[model samples]
Target: MEKIVLATSQIENIAEILEPENKNIWAWIGKAKKMGLSDYALGILPKLRIHEENEMEGLWLSAEEPEYIAEILEMENNSISLGKVKILELCSHAVETLPKLKFHGEYVMERLGLEALFSEHTAEIPKIENNSIWIGKMKRLELHFYAIEILPKFRIHRENVMEELVLNADSPEHITKILEAKDKSIWIGRVRKVSPIEHAKRIKGKLDFTLITPDDQEENGGD
Candidate 1:
């Protein structure tokens, strides 16, 4: 069998190739790590992904070929939010191994460092901008299917905040795609009131959310 290596740009092309299917195949993605070709490069590619939504744990297998396996991964987007664990991971030495291209590595380190500081001093923890409360779905992506990478999101709150931003974060009955669909139950933070793009855009949407500042901390775990 031939080995296949993927790059960030190539993964974008690959991302479009996978769609949800009933074959019991899936690919779980974790950004900030194991994204794009990071899995292939970092020697951490899963031999198979678990179809948790399918009532199976560690039951799905990757394709025999590497390229084919990547295709299989593109199909499933089931994610788990190890909320607090992610926090610890970010603040620890694991971050030292992050990719350095485009300052991506530096950005995460800075974010985690800031989070470490916030967790120690803040009255309450806020979910950061890039972080999520939705940990994906327990079922397949059927009625709930949407994408947000193209949208120009406006930060209701400012960055580098010294004040605590309050947000009512929660997780609803929707399946996540690219995002973790983070689990907000474990979160403790705040969010600002966003302008009414439509009255419900801020308070309600496909999924519920929690509050976090441009600089805040997750508890001690994450996906």
Candidate 2:
């Protein structure tokens, strides 16, 4: 009987520790750490919503396991907060796997966040409506080696009211494919050509390339 009572008390204590409060996530993280709990254990708490810039910041600072953070953000319902969370420099895996999470409905994230998180891995992330821009919060990330894979995913090629992106490729063939596909859908800054002079000249005119085209290859291309 005494063991049962202690167990009941422990359950209540955990419930209080894992209570869903959007504002004090950082504080809870500190408390949970003191109690020798893994940062991810908090992720299983139902109704836990992290929907603020500060809360996102706290999670980034405290959580060591990014997969848990990915799961926590997946439960977020606020579009505005989701926008802030995705741009964070978590692992490529965390950002790439977000689209596969079971969201409440169609969760359209800000395109800029996608640009930052999935720079080269865009093809790996499942399709989501990525168009909104949260002004004054633009982030710039260097191109990953395989960023050229973005050529086949047309969603990122949509013309935005405001955009600033740059691509650098090792081969002219890779750069050509990206430039032709982008076709001025968004503002692409001067591409740093590393292949050779002649290869550079081939894409020079297309470098300032603008004109959106249907990604006819999207259906057949494998990510």
Candidate 3:
């Protein structure tokens, strides 16, 4: 029933400081698993540790023999440490991806601080065949599940005969919500935003369509 508090970064470091290298570490690890230390916890324990006073107590417990219980305690400590590291990594990644600015054209490149970098590129809010639409790109990863991340922000008119599809913008959750909705037609387009030409092809004929671009073109690609 000992109490231990540690920051995410401190977990793995504490584990290493406390245990360094002990071949019997696996025994403690197995016991911790039985005790219900999650996979994350087991991985990070090497870095996390108790305060100086707690360390002294831990040392005493380890030396006191009973051996098996000491092993269990060690495993538990490691498990907790590993868990913290995972939590920290996930948090860090989320923060990195969170949108900093509003997803609108008003901010332009200045909002994302990409004005100078993207100076050559123009931000066009493409008009899809169906005025109301969303889109994104699809990608697959080994460890992570497949998902779509929206590319460009665009809209389609409801009256358009051709449908417009964006790639990678929609999540399964979003699609589920759309399917459950009363107005299914209004929610037309790919779940995620993707390349304009590609999206136009997907929704072509399904609805009257056009890709909104800085340059204007006829429905049949005519001037």
What tens digits encode model 3's per-residue C-alpha lDDT throughout 1-223? 3333323322455355345575354434422311222222323233333221111111001111122122333332112222101011111112111121112111111111111012111111121122322111111100011111112122322332222233221224312222332332333332121232322223223322244443433332211
Clashing pairs in 2: 183-210, 183-211, 184-210
Q: Judged by lDDT against the true structure, how good is candidate 3?
A: 0.23
The most accurate candidate by lDDT is 2
Clash counts for the predictions, in order: 31, 3, 53
Residues 1-223, candidate 1: write the lDDT tens digits. 1123343323455443244451232243422222223322222233223222222111111121243333323332223212221111121111112111011111111111111111122111121233322221111111111112111111212122212212211222111222333343222223322221222133223233343434555223222
Give each model a TM-score: 0.20, 0.36, 0.20
Error of model 2, residue 181, in angstroms: 1.5
lDDT of 2 by residue, 45-120 (tens): 3333333332122122123334434555564333323313223332333334333222222222222222223344
Tell how far residue 201 is off in model 1, in angstroms: 18
Candidate 2 Cα deviation (angstroms), residue 139: 4.4
Cα lDDT, model 3, residue 88: 17
Off by over 4 Å in 3: 1-105, 109-146, 149-209, 212-215, 220-223
